[model samples]
Target: MRNRRPVGIWLTTVLLSSGTLLLSALLAGFLAVVSFRHGWVRTSPLYGIIAFLLVSAIIGTLLSAFFSKKVLNPLIALIKATQQVAEGNFDVRLEPRSKGEVGELIRNFNRMAEELSHTEMLRSDFVNNISHEIRTPVAAIENCATLLISGQLSGAEQREYAEMIADGARRLSTLSRNVLSLSRLENQGIITERRRFRLDEQIRQAVVLLEPKWAEKRLELDIELSEVTYEGNPELMIQVWINLLENAIKFSNAGGPLIVRLSEAGGEALTTIEDRGVGMPEEVVGRIFEKFYQGNPSRAAEGNGLGLALVKRIVELSGGRVGVESRPGEGSRFSVSLPMENC
Candidate 1:
């Protein structure tokens, strides 16, 4: 674990190891010749020639075995590891063998396997969560339909059942839309459409767009924005604000004040949304941006948990960063920093 300088050290090691093997072979051959001359090898001239051939054959066989163990064994291990991985056995890994590039390669392979294992675990958990979320709405709609078909409900009951069905359908539609958007952001490698736009005005529009939701909760707004133009994908950038603002409004306590701040800092446009809601613990804040990661299961019904993930993807695609500041019982602040266009 010391300073691993990849400066011809591995090559030097291979050369030294090969030199030792060559010296060993030469010593054995010299001993065979000396023995033959000293009658230590008691045999006729023709038999002596045969004895030398046997020694050479033994040496050749030993050399083959040595090379097979030193070089071919690691390669075989790698092939086996690859086969296991292809069959979804991410838990399989190989340890470092030599102090050379092969060693480094094995280390990287182990790390890759570890990451694949974790990703597989997360994917399974996410699929299960999605199934549960979708099943709830689907079951509701099915049950409502069945009840309506019975034709034993009053006019009010019929309307209520129909409304419940509509609500369930809407929830499913929202989930589908969010999942598709997040998928596109993550899986597609298309370049983002970029242009110069007034950053402060965009922030204002996001705030105004959610005016109804915030007003319904009797929340107060504290807006402080400055004029700054940023270069990025306008359409995607707008979703960032929408998600952040929606999150702020969603978690905020009734009648609490939400603070929005925009400023210029070190050649970047900084936007921060602070919500006086029930803040989360450190562990929850750390993983909130992960796909389908909801800090509070109690509030899971309100969202399908892809908004923050999409926000992160869009921000990174535009060469920016998103971060969070929060503590339990206090408020949470989500900050986005994007490079501003040279004016």
Candidate 2:
């Protein structure tokens, strides 16, 4: 059984019941005083009735004023605040003045408002960032196409323009694919198509797939894999490895050492990707998994900010967690822990 607090409803009920009992006692006492001062036998029944009516009216008015201030006022304020929230004013907050249920209600209202405000801010940022990401590539492709159609460039210049166009198209394609994949993953609650596969082999394959990028940078690879077979969505798990590896490669300094390690501990497959690149501060590390959040502005052009967010959502759906440790200029290490059993 849940231990429930005896606040809110119980307090309100007690206050109202006590007020009613006190009012009744006062009314009875007033009638008794009138009857004793003027003899009950001598006083007219009409006078007694009139006195009772006056006393009842006055007491009722006082009680009404007291209850209105204590209960009705806060309720009215809450209604107005709700209206404001419905009108998209997420910034509205209520001061909790009353105790018991009304105070708890006001506190909840304030918390809800704060959360809605944060969500609204994130939504605005996502829209602005995505718009900029799409527009830049689109504009580049348009310019390149226009230049190519002008027929004023030499053969070498024309080829350069064509390559630029291709690059822009590729960026747009990748952005679209990432956005769609993230949307799909966000809606997914469980990983499907589970099967046992060699997790080590998958990581190795991802590294090999990005050979061109890492090779171009002359990055030294140090991989240590312990044989581990895991049951989960192979397609989605592969994306996790690819994205993390790509991120490490992109940030690594030229000819720097990139390390990949996989091992099993306590029935969890732990994988770490460490890169000798520009590490982030604590603040950046916290918000790195947020959608459209880029910690390093200088390297923002390399990719859209959806990669890590996708990695996080995928790992979570697979019943695992991903984390990172880094300090400024010392390099960063990303760790992912997945359950070895079916989740």
Candidate 3:
């Protein structure tokens, strides 16, 4: 496994050499025939041979230079760019100048570099967000503990500080559990623990579970569900409904409308959760499902940003797809579609 010469250079040299030899032989034969017809070869055979050798040498050198420029230069540039990428320089890109396969290769390499750069940016954002999320709760808990340790407060003050500490601890616990769940779901490729369950009942249960929040806001509920039994992991599917409903409850304006609907058509089940909330712009709607992507800065403190990402991953594992629609002032509508057949 020793390093060999570059294939482009080697192949180009071989082809050029073969072509020069064949062309030179044919030219020399033609020159000899013409010279014999003019009686020149008989008188000056040595001079003629010298001239023919010089001409062949000059033509071969020129052809070698031309072919090398045409073929090997792009390959050399591509090799250097590849080395840069291997060294973690995802910004490197090559200009596509050739046709056919070489052009396609350059285009694909450029696209790969762009994608890698985007992924790197996302990774950096994830690290920063997680650090902020963890640090805020930790700082709160530390402050509350310091206040409690002072032992200079009244009973009511002590209880308040203890409650603050508990709340911070609960936030930390929830963040940790969500991170673990999202990590597990991201790595999972398929849904298991399948069972036949009433999809409508599951949605209803999820709504009931979040009653406190929507009740506090006094939001109107518009529920329309058809009896549809779905075969999938009940535990995971329930999570999807809970997360979606929670999101709707979290963002809805006070006394606004919250709509939940489940129906079946064309051998597929469609469930949509719509909320009259402070909706997102086009850009935020597009990236809302990405891990740790919280588009609404004003409401970022309510939860860690892994809920929607987990919901998306679980739905996909169950052989379904999810989508969302929203406008700036209008509310958002999240739709999940699942195949009726067992998967």
Candidate 4:
């Protein structure tokens, strides 16, 4: 339906003004009748002045009401359109026939809606990426298990198939852990309680914890932290050191040297785990912290691909950051930085 506000306002203004004029004319007539008899203020002149005032008021009121309606209508429509856009309904559009500032606002609203639509598409693509990552490991596990079960094979063949099944299972476990950790880190609140402690002591503890794995591979530890001491979350930093050291051990050549150094970098406590190991490619390095992302898909490593991701998250949660430097043949270095408290 067409807006009748302007029409109704104009009609009301005219009717009211006419009523005032008629009332004034009636009063003037009454005054003329009474004053002609009573002889007060010369009835003819008083009547003329009242009539002029009534006509002037009628014209002014009508003009004001009409102009106010015209001015406010576009503003009201613009407000309503803005509300719709804020509520995420970008489909609403004002008539392009609207002119001046209001028209420009409508044009900008349409542009913003188009940009939001594109962002929604990108969000969908991210979902698809996560789904595909989850699906591949699961599919591999299913196929490998099926082959092992329906097999008629010798001892060596059975062992090989079993190993394949185990590898797939490990990868799936890794993928699940990374997804879970990402969810936690994104939402779970951090809790850090600081106490005075030796920083190198925590590194040594992490090394001792991973001793069995290193012994199995016959790896060597070249530690350099002799007197470094500071304070932070001992448990969380332990995880960082474990992850970095374990990663170094996992990727190192047989009988390779894994060097861990802890020292002061500015006022921050710095630790570096360097190993003569197989290094990551540039593409993998770029996405190393992403969920369910395995840098090397050759299954040469025994991790669930969550180790480095977890390391990064834990360090960040502890008010620290982790970095890596590596090359194809050269070893990789994982560095961790944390706030240092004087001990």
The best candidate in terms of TM-score: 2
Looking at candidate 3, what is the lDDT of residue 152?
88
Give a tens-digit lDDT track for model 4, residues 1-343: 2332345545655675567556655666665566656666554756655665576566655665665556556656766666766776667766655678767876777787778867676567657756676676678678767777887677787788778777777767766666675667667567367666788888888899999989998988788995677666666567678878878888899899999898886778888899888987788788877644677778534555667777888788777788889887788998888876455
lDDT of each: 0.84, 0.87, 0.87, 0.73
The C-alpha TM-scores of every prediction are: 0.80, 0.83, 0.80, 0.60
Model 3 misplacement above 4 A: 1-40, 151-153, 187-189, 211-224, 253-259, 274-287, 319-333
RMSD to native for every prediction? 7.5, 6.8, 3.9, 8.1
Candidate 1 ranges with C-alpha deviation above 4 Å: 1-44, 98-105, 188-191
Q: After superposition, how far is residue 63 of candidate 1 from its true place, in Å?
A: 4.4
Please provide, for model 2 over 257-288, each residue's C-alpha lDDT reduced to its tens digit, 9 standing for 90 to 100: 99999999999999999998988899999999
Residue-pair clashes, model 1? 0
**Model 2 scores what on Cα lDDT?**
0.87
Q: Candidate 1 on 1-343: residue-level lDDT in tens?
A: 2333433544645665566556655666676677878988876545655566567657766775676468756766776787788888999988786768888888999999999999999889878978987998999999999999999999999999999999999989988888888878878665366688888999899999998999999999999999988877788889999999999999999999999999998888889999989988999998999888899999887888889999999888777899999988888999999876453
* Tens-place lDDT digits, model 3, residues 243-272: 999999888899999999999998899999
Better-scoring candidate (lDDT), 1 or 4? 1
In candidate 3, position 131 carries an lDDT of 95
